[model samples]
Target: MKNHRKGHLINKGNAPYVLLAPTILIFVLFMIYPIIRSLYLSFFELKSGCYQFVGLHNYIVLFHDRTFYKSLFNTVVYLVIQVPVMILLALAIAVLIEEKFLRGKAFFRTSVFLPSITALVAYALVFKVLLNGDHGLINYVIELFGAKGVNWFYGEWSARIAIIMAITWRWTGYNMIILLAGIQSIPDSLQEAARIDGATARQRFVYITVPMVKQIILFCTITSTIGTLQLFDEPFILTSGGPNNATITMGEYLYDNGFRYLKFGYASAIGYVMTIIIFLLSALQFKATAKGDTD
Candidate 1:
């Protein structure tokens, strides 16, 4: 009876693990293994499909690579410009959509949010055709207004502008949804209290609404930073990182190195460097958020 009871207890304890075993096994096999393997590969060079240990050589070379610096600069430009604009725009749209005076709220929300659900490739392809230098819809529309048709693909700044516009269009709705949720979570009583204290609408928004949703804003900002840093799809499809390498981001550089040049080791190094950058940026944001909260 004692042995039987012990086995029964053991079986009960093992049930959860048995149920979770498949998921756990899959995670280890795919996510964990790939990350570990990538780190291992980062330290070595591949030659003739064989690994040759290079210690820190790949990383050392990365530090001095002009293309890597150019890629980094391009990513930083996107992070600085596109991210803030998108975040603020999303926040504005979220705030506007939540107002009681807004007519046909459901329709407005759906119309705005529709882009978020659109496929990236589809969106990029559409933008590519729409922004084409010659005989494009946007230029055609401009011509309708009796204005000269400016070719988006022909100018460096225009290409960057077009890429930013595409990303902003595609992602603003998604971020707006996030911020809207954050806004809804805030209690109306607080806003009412601020109003009763003779605070203006703008004051309530700045003092009451913003602080309440600061965490969500930080989350969006950090995610946007990482996303912008890794931006590939928009530039890839739209400009191919061109009008000159003006749009060439780190992800594009990583792809070119890994696939085009077949410099797997160098690419691995670039990947790890980007991983470190993302980690550091996330940490900095968290630290800043904490400091802001304390203050």
Candidate 2:
């Protein structure tokens, strides 16, 4: 009887593991296996079903690749400019929408958020038409002032501006919604007490509101940074990386290498490099934000 009871307890303890077996197997097969396979492929020369071991060759080639460097530079520029602008704009919108005295709050919120819900392809097509140099709506407006329409996608700087505009239009509202949720999570009594203490609106925002939302802001910053690092669609669709590879991003380069050029190994290496850079950048951002919070 004692042995039978012990055996029963052992079986009971193993039951949960048995239940989780399918999920664990699926995760390993889908996620873990792909990552490991890609990493291995990155160290080789892929040809047909066979690979030749060429350790570090892909990475070495990446260093000499001018297009890769250009893509890296463009990606950095996008992150530096787009991330701050989007986050700041989102914060402003969230604060305004969350104000108790604000009327038509639903209308404002919905209107602002509508762009985020719009299909990416639809928005890209609209932007392409709007930014067209000859007869685009934006240039048509500029032509009213007797100015020649700018070649938005033809020039390097103009191409970058167009890409930034597209990114901001699509993502700012999503960030705002995240921030609004954070703002709503803050207790109303704190703001009421601050008001009762004769705190100015600006003072309340800087002191009470900002501090409470720092974590959410940090979360947004990290996520936005990762997204910017992997940004592909806007540049690919909007400018095709421009007339001179001006707006090529890491993600674009990866796609070009893996699919267009059929250099899967090189693409895998680029992907891994991008993964590392994104991880490092995100870690640094989180640390800096945490330190600012303490200060």
Candidate 3:
């Protein structure tokens, strides 16, 4: 009976693994295989359907590549500036909309979220027209206000600004929805108790509400960090990494290397570098948040 019972427990333990066999097989076939293949490719020099084992050459070239550095710098700049701005704006908006005193909350939420759901190509084209240097709607409006119309896409900084604006407009509302869910999950009794204790609105928020929602805020921070790190579509579609590569991001650079220039090995090295950077940054963010929570 003891041996039979032991065998039964062993079978029970193995049941989950047996059930998950297909999923594991698929993951090995799709994700694991590609990752291993890419790593192998990164170590080679490929030309004309022939390859040489030129280990670290692609990585060395990437280090000396000015375009790669420029794209890296631009990506870091966007992550630093845009992530905090969008997260803060979203938090504020979420708090406001979740307030009981706010009227027509549904309408307001929907309106704000509309931009996020809009097709990227459609919005990019619309913004291009609106921000046209001379005849664009925005420039025309600025002229009406007795201000000089600026060329948005012609200058490096101006082109980056356009990319930032487009990303912020599209994503802020999605962040707001996440924060709104966090806000709503807080117990109303806590707020009532604080109010009864003569806490001002600001004090209640700073002391109670913010502390309670700290985990959700950390979640948003990490997700936003990852998204900003992988940023590609907006910059690619809107600016095309112009004028003179000022707005180039890692993803765009990777695409250019792989598809346009046919430097597959070099592109794979870029991909590996990007993966490492993203991992380090995300780990740092997680550590900071965890430390803050502990303190």
Name the best candidate (by lDDT). Answer: 2
Could you tell me the lDDT of residue 65 within candidate 3? 96
Candidate 2 vs candidate 3: which has greater lDDT?
Answer: 2
**TM-score, model 2 to reference:** 0.91
lDDT of each: 0.89, 0.93, 0.90
lDDT by residue (1-295, candidate 2, tens digit) is 9999999999999999999999999999999999999999899986777888999999999999999999999999999999999999999999999998999999999999999999988899899999998889999999999988899999998999999999999999999999999999999999999999999989988998889999999999899999999999889998888779999999999999999998889999999999999999989988898788688
Candidate 1 per-residue C-alpha lDDT over 48-137 given as tens digits, one digit per residue, 9 for 90 to 100: 889999999999999999878988988887788899999999998888888878899888778888998999999999999988768889
Order of candidate numbers by TM-score, starting with the best:
1, 2, 3
Q: Write the per-residue lDDT of candidate 3 for residues 123-152, one digit (tens) a residue.
A: 988888888898998889989999999899
Assess every candidate by TM-score. 0.93, 0.91, 0.90
Which regions of candidate 3 are displaced past 4 Å?
1-26
- C-alpha lDDT of residue 141 in model 3: 91
The local distance difference test score of model 2 is 0.93
Give the CA lDDT, 0 to 100, for residue 240 in model 1: 85
Superposition error at 264 for model 2 (Å): 0.7
Cα error, candidate 3, residue 109 (Å):
1.6
